[model samples]
Target: MANDFPFFKKQSNNWVYTLLLLPLWLVLYLNLQIIADFLIDDLLQLQNGNHLTEALRFFIFETPKVLLLLILIIFLVGIIRSYFTPEKTRKILGNKSLFTGNILASLLGIVTPFCSCSAIPLFLGFVEAGIPLGVTFSFLIAAPMINEVALVLLIGLFGWKVAIIYIGTGLLIAIFAGWILGKLKLERYVADWVYKVQIGQSEEEEKLKFSERIGGGYAAVKEIVGKIWIYILIGIAVGAGAHGYVPEDYLGTLLGRGNWYGVPLAILIGIPMYSNAAGIIPIVSVLIEKGVSLGTALAFMMSVIALSLPEVIILKKVLKWPLIAFFIGIVTSGILVVGFLFNVIM
Candidate 1:
């Protein structure tokens, strides 16, 4: 009966699946927005109060909402990713020219929720599945940089325009960086030890059923939330402090357009940090409010998200120093360009 609909018949099964998921996605998005709104409103009220106890109360209240949103969103993304067989991904990526493959791979990366540590295993999986080094690099860069959690947080905090720019710029960086790296023939720069490890048995046959996928998504939410709870707390705490106490004039003076060093300093400051998208965005919001240039703040956020110390450390296990350095250089330049662009435009 459903197939009788002309529109449904015209669209492929993948599009059908996407349509089916739309309602769930919308519900989750609305829930997250409501939670964020509640937090902001409550925090504002606390700020209005002169009592010293208000700060502690705001912290205690807002933490749970943030954690809950993170867990729910992460779990949903994980469950969806669980269904994506490496073989299927390879098939889509295979036979395509380098340019097309890099673009596809970077777009695909936006849907995955892999962290820096998880990227190595998945990177190996992509290689084993016969995906090209450059295409795989595109995926690796995208997965951590433009994830669901980050996208949702950005949309919730900054509206769709900024979110779209962030996503678009991130993909551009990944695609071009991967393509350039691939042209350099840097595969030899992968560590010798990585090659020594035997490829494991394929798990494609063990694909989860829909119910199982849902369960796995739930578990993923719990696991990720547990691991990153501290980072979220610390990041938000700093943001909240800055929101309440940072001097706007001083921030404007330092990070203003006249200060050419502000952008580079923001980039440098972001490199060593180990915060996720959800955690860093609130901080970015605070910085922008305190007079940080949008481009500088965005560059800082991208640097932190795309090239963290831990991410680089994890990549070292799979990549040689030369390749890793090249990756960093490409992405850093991309971030800087994006920063300057936003500064000029916004």
Candidate 2:
């Protein structure tokens, strides 16, 4: 429908059209709270202090706001990512030393936006490009774990301090994990198919015009938001339930810093679950407010996003069981350490 409209279609490639939409974006972003208040406070008569009502209202309010943020951020990120495809990333890392490549790959993962589902292709691409095993691991770990969606959502919900901690710890995990794997000489564990398969190259890819980049951004919003909106709703729903109804003491005792088991328990629970950062951060916010330790909750959140069961299954095409197990073990140990250290210190 938007494609049929001249103004909307033109916005895809035109800076003027893009600028014109800012007012609309600003209006929607600013007024989501007002709309939530009307629905929860006025229409539903949900008083502020009531737990159930507060939970429902929190869900109602956060769902759209988070979605809106996701759409906008993902749109811009999509544009950024368009410039740094797996092929380009492999090329960039091909010439660097392992230490430098690992560092750069970890940073690139923030902007590249490759999810775990793409692990096989990305691994193959890097290997084919003659990139180092440890550097590849660095990119793989950082790509999903330190993604912009998680960072932005964390900042929005818990403020910059928590977001920064998550980023710093996540990057450290990626860098050291890759470096360790590099030291271990695990290249023999990669699947045979990866070595045999050839990804054919095309003519030099043409650069997209600014307008086309803008169009890519809009396309990204449609694709990403369409896919993840349901997850966002489910996350918000869980968060609301926790916010309004869960007993603070129960949460504190179970996930609070004082409980030695809290960190591992959180990680254990998070592994089987599947959710992106956009879906999980709201729940983290509720948990923290209910007295869950920041480290424990962040650990849980990272496990859900970074080490999901689905991701492991997907990676089976490229990595053998031994290699996968090693990867998981190393990363999990790091996460546990991070949780305990943060819990003890902060």
**Per-prediction TM-score, please?**
0.73, 0.85
Candidate 2 Cα RMSD after full superposition onto the native fold (Å): 3.2
Which digits, one per residue and each the tens of the lDDT, describe model 1 over residues 1-346?
Answer: 2244344343334345545766765675557546544555564454535434445544544555565556667767877787665456666887767789999988878765455656778877777666788988888888778987676666544567888999999999999999998889888998877656778776546645565565556556656666667766875565455545645698777876668878888888999997777678877877876889888988999999888898888888889899989998988888889888888898
Candidate 2 Cα outliers beyond 4 Å, as residue runs: 1-8, 11-13, 27-61, 237-246, 249-251, 282-286
The 10 consecutive residues of candidate 1 with the worst lDDT sum are: 1-10
| TM-score between model 2 and native | 0.85
Residue 173 miss distance in model 2 (angstroms): 0.9
Report, for all candidates in order, the number of backbone clashes.
0, 1
What lDDT score is found at residue 138 in candidate 1?
Answer: 88
lDDT of candidate model 2 versus the reference: 0.82
Model 1 spans with C-alpha error above 4 angstroms: 1-72, 85-91, 193-197, 225-246
Instruction: Please report the TM-score between candidate 1 and the true structure.
Output: 0.73
